[model samples]
Target: MTETMREVEAGATRELRRYAPLAANDNREDYSLRFAAVSFRRWRPFVVATAALGGIAYLADFAIGASIVLSFGFTSGVLAILAAALVIFLTGIPIAAACARSGVDMDLLTRGAGFGYLGSTLTSLVYGSFTVIFFSLEGAIMAQALEMALHLPLWLGYLVSTLIVLPFAMYGMGAIAKMQTWTQPLWIAGLILPFVVIAVREPGRFAEFASFAGTDGTHGSFSAVGFGFGMGVALSLIGQIGEQADYLRFMPPKTAENKRAWWTAVIAAGPGWVVLGAAKQIGGAFLAFCALGVVGAAHAVEPIAPYVEAVRPALGPMAIALSALFVVISQIKINTTNAYSGSLSFANFFSRVLHRHPGRVWYVLVNCGIALALMEFGAFGFLNKILGFYSNVGIAWIGALVAHLVIVKPLGLAPPYIEFKRAYLPSINPVGFGSMVIASVVSIVAFFGAFGQTAAAFSPLLALVIAMVLVPLFAYLTKGRYYLKRPNTVAGPDVPAALLAGTHECLACGEHYELPDIADCPAHSGAICSLCCTLETTCGTACQEPGAEPVSLGMPTMKLS
Candidate 1:
């Protein structure tokens, strides 16, 4: 070989060495919260359903909804919540499908969509923010329940609430699935008993509730400004779909026989998360109405206290005690999810940013730490406006994600399925990433009254709209090059037996995957599990088998019409 050719080869070898770890996994930690080789995916459909029910973890859904009602009255609160639910349902479908079909996390999907290898760091902040911020909120609710029923000190309650989660989380999904399944009946009973007793005792109160004016003193009339304001807050839950997707990834392999169950689980857990969420929101509004009159308007929106009161009419003092239990259990159901997904986001953040693969558990604790810090700083008092405003940015990110997954990919403007192996994808795809940034900027501007009070009030929704339109526009103009770098040839292929031997270990996380699920990772110079593929960072998009796909290199394309 010529001297220059030898130098080029040497450089190529060095680059390969840097990324060689991408193909391997650290079996030492076993994919963090993941269930490495477990076959629990084979369980009955009911388990999946119950697990999906766990999506009802956040207390803010109810609190936020109640505040909307208390601020805007029934018409605005109810209507705004319903509207937000509809939007969330539509957006969550494609995102959930990508998770189940590809069996990768949201971070991986974002990487392939348009954010280059390093570009996804922006999303990492958004997702991690969602996790930690919500964790503090949920943990605070847990503390409130403790203070109300058990009379525990607020600070201690916070400590208990936060620490209780560590044991369950460290065990990962095997522990979570079992815990969720076993607790479903108790959780259901706790959630319903208050309503059941309320109906028995306060049949006349609900009629009174319909006409109850909010703290804002807005009487029974349509207020466009209030409606817009309420929606700005309600729309923040759109990214809760990420939490749903986290669990949905474990859906067992779909086949013709279990097709019905699989689709039900996917839909129920995916978009259907909002249905239950909407119910909680409405119930929260109602409960706030019930309490606000008695507790003063400021305390009216607190669902836990009113819920305890309603249960007391029939269940007696036992209800207060039960309220305490309800708070802790519900928080556990949701916070595990919050912490779990948070950890995943941080893993994505640090892995992509620093080119290091810490165990997912480490990031989990890190996420929780940030949340606890926020709690100590008194974030709970400002939860309503805080969630409302943050929703704008959250919606922008997820909105772009959903747009690419549903709108762009289906029209042949982007890739058909998620390409997340890092080897086959570009370091950045501009379609999803650029659109999200633009959407966030515009929505944030609108939020700040730049476009008038009405527009500023409902900026989150605006962001969502902007991302939906811009992602497709960018995809069309860029010819979908932003999605991947090398053409995708790994998935939907005949597998080599040696690769799937069920014993082939990945070099990064150092674990073995079923041969069928394992793929050769040129980035790491070894086989890699799908999860590790997402967690890898050093590999540039060089595993496309040489022109097998148009990933991120800005190559010219040939039309296939």
Candidate 2:
């Protein structure tokens, strides 16, 4: 035993230069690539949910809502919005639960859900793109508000908008949660004020809005083609659940005592976000209808223009200032989340590719920098075009994730719990990765009109169907062998209470981690933390070799000083 202990001590720490940033934990880097430690999961269910839900404050919903309604007319647009909302809500349920219960972010969850280690790097790219794209979109909205209210040049406003969110996001969840909580009341009030004013001041506008023919001259009649196209646009927001999971992973372990609150928070802040999102879309359509005569269809889709018009009756001369303020507040609340989650996604991607993790904070610059560039090039000008196309890829990725979590896992075709540790997972799992790729390729081809106009209009829906079908098909065909490279019987059961019950000292980092984040390692000759497992390069996966002692499956036997 003494000789074995000495050998373990001499095995080398092998800490990555990049992991220093995460080790600092000053900003609660909060285990960006590993399980969110139970020790740090201190927030109440409601608080975490609030922080997650707060990320949806971006006015892009308004833009998306108005654009679809204006292009497709009232009936088709409204039906499409409701339909997309239902899809997002239902899919969000299992995903949100899995992430929260596993204490891992979307990227980690993806790895365990059948994408394997390197396979999920693609998803990291997909999710990171979602953040950057939306960051640019939300930043553009705020920039417009700045330009409108203060005459700031669009370029300068973009710069200002980009700079403003850095301080809040740099500090990660602690700072972000407080900011989101503090601003929630004001945002809610501002959100509803314009609609209330419209209702009271112009009671007949609602009736008029219902029958408005739209810019396409559909005469307000429902068109199947228009509805399909509109639904595709709305489905782009499916990626928003990933941002929610980033926060939801920090949820405290659900207990019998907090069960009701836990479920409520998970549902409301998790999948239930689309409920409010759908309402906001409808409200945006209403506001766009109210402003159509004043601003014309071109400017009506810009959220600031319709918002200013909607509140003009109530606020009079102050409408512009208040509307600008609301826009700024709303954008800040969401853009911080975008930058924050983007950093997480990028950090996960590069860490695996480069085998180094400089930390989550540095990637905030990468995320925001990319977004700022996008704004400069006018990504917002192609709002519908960009979102419409992105919806296909986004839905395909999300659809595969949801199908694995909700269907295959329940049906015993995949692991019952998440297995995210790199030491124990294969480099790639074809189940999810292959499904997402095939679905994305096929749907994108359809989106580009290769499959006819109607197919092009509904490409994203096609992606969803293909991905959902493929997850179970691939899982069964692979016989669930690829889900985990090795079984994990170490520490304890994967339940929240069991995972949070004890701590193990990671031999590589000399830090204690909860059971869920620590794994046995033959290469290190001791138990190692997941982050250390991810960054270690010299091991060459000796732990996973045939008859290699199966270190990750059983508890570590080495004594810890």
Ten-residue region with minimum lDDT total, candidate 1: 552-561
So what's the TM-score on candidate 1? 0.86
For candidate 2, the 10 contiguous residues with the lowest summed lDDT are 1-10
lDDT of 1 at 165: 85
lDDT of 2 by residue, 1-561 (tens): 001122233664354223454545745576788788677889999899999999999899999999889888899999999999999999999999988988989999999888999999999999999999999999999999999999999999999999999998888999999999999999999999988997888889899888877886754788888999999999999999999999999999889999999999999999999999999998998898888889998889889999999888789999899999999999999999999999999999998888777678889999999999999999999998899899999999899998998889889988777888887799888899999999999999999999899999999999999999999999999898998877765643453453345677777666667777888888766678888788777888788898877454333333332
Q: Cα deviation in Å at residue 219, candidate 1? A: 3.6
Candidate number of the best lDDT: 2
Cα error, residue 532 of model 1, in Å, equals 6.7
What shift in Å separates residue 518 of candidate 1 from its native position after superposition? 5.5
Relative to the true structure, how large is the alpha-carbon lDDT of every model? 0.71, 0.88
User: Which sections of candidate 1 miss by over 4 Å?
Assistant: 1-40, 492-511, 514-561
Candidate 2 residue pairs in backbone clash: none
Could you tell me how far off, in angstroms, the CA of residue 453 lies in candidate 1 after the best superposition? 0.6
For residues 1-561, write the lDDT of model 1, one tens digit per residue. Answer: 001111144355222122222212332232432322323345555565567567576677767877888888887778888888998898888888777655556776677666766677888888889888888888888888888887888788777888888766666666777888888788888877877877887788778777766776655777777777887787888778887777777676677998888788888888898998888888888887877757777666666777777777877768778788888889998888788788878876776556555466777689888888887777888977788778888998988887877777779876665555555556667787788888888988888789999898778888988998988889899887666655443332343423322345555444445443444666556566555565554464456556543322111122222
User: Which portions of model 2 show Cα errors greater than 4 Å?
Assistant: 1-18, 21-23, 491-500, 552-561
Give the TM-score of each candidate. Answer: 0.86, 0.94
